[model samples]
Target: MDTILGVSKLSSKFQVTIPKDVREILKVSPGDRIVFIHEEGKIIIKKA
Candidate 1:
Protein backbone atom coordinates (compact mmCIF):
# COMPACT_ATOMS: atom_id res chain seq x y z
CA MET A 1 0.00 0.00 0.00
CA ASP A 2 1.08 3.57 -0.54
CA THR A 3 1.63 6.16 2.12
CA ILE A 4 -1.45 7.58 3.78
CA LEU A 5 -1.86 11.10 2.48
CA GLY A 6 -5.27 11.96 3.89
CA VAL A 7 -8.26 10.60 5.73
CA SER A 8 -12.03 11.13 5.74
CA LYS A 9 -14.94 9.92 7.79
CA LEU A 10 -17.60 7.90 6.01
CA SER A 11 -21.04 9.37 6.30
CA SER A 12 -24.24 7.55 7.21
CA LYS A 13 -25.09 7.42 3.53
CA PHE A 14 -22.03 5.24 2.91
CA GLN A 15 -20.31 8.16 1.33
CA VAL A 16 -17.05 9.80 2.22
CA THR A 17 -15.80 13.18 1.13
CA ILE A 18 -12.31 13.07 -0.26
CA PRO A 19 -9.82 15.12 1.65
CA LYS A 20 -8.26 18.18 0.10
CA ASP A 21 -4.72 16.77 0.16
CA VAL A 22 -5.87 13.69 -1.65
CA ARG A 23 -7.70 15.81 -4.18
CA GLU A 24 -4.54 17.76 -4.81
CA ILE A 25 -2.61 14.55 -5.29
CA LEU A 26 -5.25 13.26 -7.67
CA LYS A 27 -5.40 16.60 -9.48
CA VAL A 28 -9.15 16.39 -9.51
CA SER A 29 -11.90 18.91 -9.11
CA PRO A 30 -15.66 19.01 -8.99
CA GLY A 31 -17.33 17.11 -11.88
CA ASP A 32 -14.19 15.09 -12.53
CA ARG A 33 -14.70 11.36 -12.98
CA ILE A 34 -13.16 8.96 -10.48
CA VAL A 35 -12.27 5.37 -11.14
CA PHE A 36 -12.60 2.76 -8.43
CA ILE A 37 -10.48 -0.38 -8.40
CA HIS A 38 -10.81 -3.42 -6.16
CA GLU A 39 -7.49 -5.10 -5.69
CA GLU A 40 -5.77 -6.97 -2.90
CA GLY A 41 -8.45 -6.10 -0.39
CA LYS A 42 -8.12 -2.41 -1.09
CA ILE A 43 -10.29 0.05 -2.92
CA ILE A 44 -8.18 2.29 -5.08
CA ILE A 45 -9.51 5.61 -6.30
CA LYS A 46 -8.08 7.55 -9.21
CA LYS A 47 -9.00 10.42 -11.47
CA ALA A 48 -10.42 9.38 -14.77
Candidate 2:
Protein backbone atom coordinates (compact mmCIF):
# COMPACT_ATOMS: atom_id res chain seq x y z
CA MET A 1 0.00 0.00 0.00
CA ASP A 2 1.16 3.48 -0.74
CA THR A 3 0.73 5.85 2.16
CA ILE A 4 1.42 9.51 2.40
CA LEU A 5 2.97 9.91 5.80
CA GLY A 6 3.77 13.58 5.64
CA VAL A 7 4.48 16.63 3.56
CA SER A 8 6.43 19.83 4.08
CA LYS A 9 6.62 23.21 2.46
CA LEU A 10 9.89 24.64 1.28
CA SER A 11 11.04 27.64 3.23
CA SER A 12 12.58 30.86 1.99
CA LYS A 13 16.03 29.47 2.57
CA PHE A 14 15.14 26.38 0.54
CA GLN A 15 14.90 24.23 3.61
CA VAL A 16 12.14 21.91 4.66
CA THR A 17 11.88 20.32 8.06
CA ILE A 18 11.11 16.67 7.92
CA PRO A 19 7.74 15.74 9.35
CA LYS A 20 7.60 13.45 12.37
CA ASP A 21 5.97 10.58 10.51
CA VAL A 22 8.43 10.87 7.65
CA ARG A 23 11.32 11.03 10.06
CA GLU A 24 10.12 7.89 11.77
CA ILE A 25 9.72 6.13 8.45
CA LEU A 26 13.26 7.04 7.46
CA LYS A 27 14.59 6.25 10.94
CA VAL A 28 16.63 9.42 10.87
CA SER A 29 17.98 11.37 13.81
CA PRO A 30 19.23 14.90 14.18
CA GLY A 31 22.75 14.14 12.96
CA ASP A 32 21.71 11.43 10.53
CA ARG A 33 22.52 11.90 6.87
CA ILE A 34 19.96 11.68 4.10
CA VAL A 35 20.26 11.48 0.35
CA PHE A 36 18.07 13.22 -2.18
CA ILE A 37 18.03 11.99 -5.71
CA HIS A 38 16.34 13.31 -8.78
CA GLU A 39 15.23 10.42 -10.87
CA GLU A 40 12.46 9.92 -13.42
CA GLY A 41 11.20 13.44 -12.88
CA LYS A 42 10.72 12.84 -9.21
CA ILE A 43 12.64 13.44 -6.03
CA ILE A 44 13.62 10.38 -4.08
CA ILE A 45 14.59 10.83 -0.44
CA LYS A 46 16.21 8.20 1.66
CA LYS A 47 18.50 7.82 4.64
CA ALA A 48 22.11 7.59 3.69
Candidate 3:
Protein backbone atom coordinates (compact mmCIF):
# COMPACT_ATOMS: atom_id res chain seq x y z
CA MET A 1 0.00 0.00 0.00
CA ASP A 2 1.06 3.59 -0.60
CA THR A 3 1.93 5.74 2.37
CA ILE A 4 2.39 9.42 3.08
CA LEU A 5 6.06 10.31 3.46
CA GLY A 6 5.92 13.90 4.56
CA VAL A 7 4.56 17.35 3.81
CA SER A 8 6.06 20.59 2.57
CA LYS A 9 4.80 24.14 2.23
CA LEU A 10 5.42 26.35 -0.74
CA SER A 11 7.92 29.11 -0.21
CA SER A 12 7.41 32.79 -1.02
CA LYS A 13 9.03 32.19 -4.40
CA PHE A 14 6.53 29.43 -5.18
CA GLN A 15 9.03 26.62 -4.69
CA VAL A 16 8.89 23.52 -2.54
CA THR A 17 11.43 21.00 -1.37
CA ILE A 18 10.66 17.36 -1.97
CA PRO A 19 10.57 15.32 1.20
CA LYS A 20 13.55 13.02 1.74
CA ASP A 21 11.48 9.85 1.78
CA VAL A 22 9.73 10.76 -1.46
CA ARG A 23 13.00 11.66 -3.12
CA GLU A 24 14.56 8.40 -2.05
CA ILE A 25 11.56 6.49 -3.30
CA LEU A 26 11.62 8.31 -6.62
CA LYS A 27 15.41 7.96 -6.90
CA VAL A 28 15.94 11.57 -7.87
CA SER A 29 18.99 13.68 -7.26
CA PRO A 30 20.37 17.12 -7.86
CA GLY A 31 20.22 18.41 -11.47
CA ASP A 32 17.64 15.79 -12.41
CA ARG A 33 14.61 16.90 -14.43
CA ILE A 34 11.12 16.56 -13.00
CA VAL A 35 7.86 16.74 -14.89
CA PHE A 36 4.58 18.10 -13.64
CA ILE A 37 1.26 16.81 -14.87
CA HIS A 38 -2.09 18.41 -14.25
CA GLU A 39 -5.18 16.24 -14.35
CA GLU A 40 -8.51 16.10 -12.60
CA GLY A 41 -7.62 18.96 -10.25
CA LYS A 42 -4.48 17.26 -9.07
CA ILE A 43 -0.81 17.80 -9.85
CA ILE A 44 1.62 14.95 -10.31
CA ILE A 45 5.40 15.06 -10.37
CA LYS A 46 7.52 12.55 -12.19
CA LYS A 47 11.18 12.25 -13.01
CA ALA A 48 11.99 13.12 -16.56
Candidate achieving the largest TM-score: 3
Q: Model 1 over residues 1-48: C-alpha lDDT tens digits?
A: 678877888899998899889999999999999999999999989898
For model 2, residues 1-48, the per-residue Cα lDDT tens digits are 757778889999999999999898899999999999999997889999
Deviation in Å, model 1, residue 9 alpha carbon: 0.9
Which parts of model 1 are misplaced by more than 4 Å?
none
Report the alpha-carbon TM-score of model 3 versus the true structure: 0.81
Q: Is candidate 2 or candidate 3 better by TM-score?
A: 3
Compose the digit string of candidate 3's lDDT tens values, residues 9-36.
9999999999999899889999999999
User: How does residue 41 of candidate 1 score in lDDT?
Assistant: 100
Ranking by TM-score: 3, 1, 2
lDDT score, candidate 1, position 11:
90
Per-residue error for 35 in candidate 2, Å, reads 0.5
Which sections of candidate 3 miss by over 4 Å?
Answer: none
